[model samples]
Target: MGAGQSKAESDEHFSEEVVNNLSDNLASPDTPPERQSSLDAHIRSRIQVELARLREEEEHVREEIERALEKENLDRERDMAGDETDSGVGQVKSTTALLGDVDELRKQVERFHSKKDDDDFVAARLKSEAVVQCYKNNPSTTLDCWKQVDEFKASVAHLEERYVESLR
Candidate 1:
């Protein structure tokens, strides 16, 4: 194996030396016709081979860069997704708290309406009872019953004002 390696090394050196000599000769002003075409073909083939190799190297480098960029983009997306998930959890908590507050407010409103209805019923019943009592006490004149009716109206107005003030 060692002998073969040495032979290969010597062959490479010899080929390099031959190519250098040919290049130097061809570059001179006194170019020979017999060797001109052969040397020109050889030089053209060498340049084409080098250009192809360089192109392959460029493609390989481009592929490596693309892979690296793709991985970086994926990592960035994952980080953004994680942040969104964290914010989303916070939003859900806040929404839940708001909903609880709304429910409590709805219950309070329902209770207030219930109380208002009860007050109305009581006031109406009292007015009716007062009217009947006034009629029984003053059966002689309908004019005397105006006082009780006016008093009942004033009481109902006062109750309405109180209810409005309590809401405020």
Candidate 2:
């Protein structure tokens, strides 16, 4: 206890001396050249020492962070391993059921796709989008979209004919 207290007191005194030395150097610019050089060298050495201490502290902190990260990773791996043996079994069963549902959905989707005429549907959708965009761009001159509206109507009619034929 006594040694620690004395060390703290000495550190405080050392810092005070450094501060006083800096102030004295700044306050007395006309100080003797030799004294000024000595002060400069002292301040530089103190700065280098402080920098080295900071670097050592930084390395220690980096090591601690790496250790913590590794611990967390190990914990995560353990949890993942535990999960695979427990809830994961139930999940696998549910996933298998879901896969069967997906296969049924795929068959239905294929049947629906067979009824669709892609070319006619794409033409109709494109024409519809063009008409809507024309109306949006020319809000005040809605008549300017007449050509687009006609094209959209024609494409939709063609698409409808294809759909009815597919139904037959």
Candidate 3:
């Protein structure tokens, strides 16, 4: 087997040398007609064989790449479909929970407003409204509303003191 392989390799090398020599000889004016035509045919056949092999290799690589891309696209589509179903369920649950939370907040705000009728809150609120009215009535004489502003500040301070004492 080794001897046969070496013989084949040597024959290939010899063929290349003959081809090179024949090409050079064919280019000169004194070449024989029969030998020139035969060398030219051999060289052309070798080139055609090599080109066919290269085209086959390129086609094989192209097929492999196309198959890989197709598999990737299928996997991506499957993942997206799964995510859509999961997200749809999650969104429904989250939306209902959010609505319940919003309703609780609205009830809290209503209760706070109802409690605003208490005596101290009403007094502070009334004083604040008076200060706003005074400022509106005397826009150019802002200093004139000092008495109303002072009364509002005193009411707010009293409310703060009561809140701190309740905390203690």
Candidate 4:
């Protein structure tokens, strides 16, 4: 047989020997009835104590496991929220850049129209009107971008506050 199998067999034999010894001691006819009852009660009390200790240990382990799971869940949620905030900031940056480009384009178009003859006046006016309409449609877009950046900053501040509170 393998070494592992031999070791297992030995362990089983040891356990059986221990059980036999315990049974023989408990069943000895030389033991007085009152003494035997007292011994039994003492054994019962010891078993109850051991059981209570084991139950307490089990409860402690369960509480630790639950705390770890809750911490992991909170960390996952925090990471997801951070990713969403980053995506929002990226979008806001892109929109801000596009607005800047549009403003530059409008300026260039105006310069070109100013240098042109009266014949181009109608086309230049139409282009300028279109630009004006675009600005009018979303007058608060730039303001909104600024607000988003501010809000992002505020969120960081709030997180710091919460972290400090937790430490306390």
What overall lDDT goes with each candidate model? 0.83, 0.85, 0.86, 0.71
Give candidate 2 misplaced runs (Cα > 4 Å): 1-31, 87-125, 133-168
Per-residue lDDT tens digits of candidate 1, residues 1-168? 899999999999999999999999778878677678899999999999999999999999999999999999778766766777787853222345669999999999998878767866578668868988999998898678997798788877877887788789
Better of 2 and 3 by TM-score: 2
Off by over 4 Å in 3: 1-28, 89-168
Question: By lDDT, is 1 or 2 better?
Answer: 2
Better of 2 and 4 by TM-score: 2
Q: TM-scores of all models?
A: 0.36, 0.39, 0.36, 0.36
Candidate 4 lDDT by residue in tens digits, 1-168: 699999999999999999999999878778888988999999999999999999999999999999999999778766766787787853222345669999999997886656454433444455555555655666877444454445445555655665467459
> Which number leads on TM-score?
2
Candidate 4 similarity to native, TM-score: 0.36
**Model 3 residue 33 distance off true place after TM-score fit, in angstroms:** 1.3
**Best candidate (score: lDDT):** 3
Tell me the RMSD of model 2 versus the true structure.
13.5
User: How does model 3 score by TM-score?
Assistant: 0.36
**Where does model 4 exceed 4 Å of error?**
1-28, 88-168
Which residues of candidate 1, in runs, are more than 4 Å off? 1-28, 89-168
- How far does residue 135 in candidate 4 sit from its true spot (Å)? 62
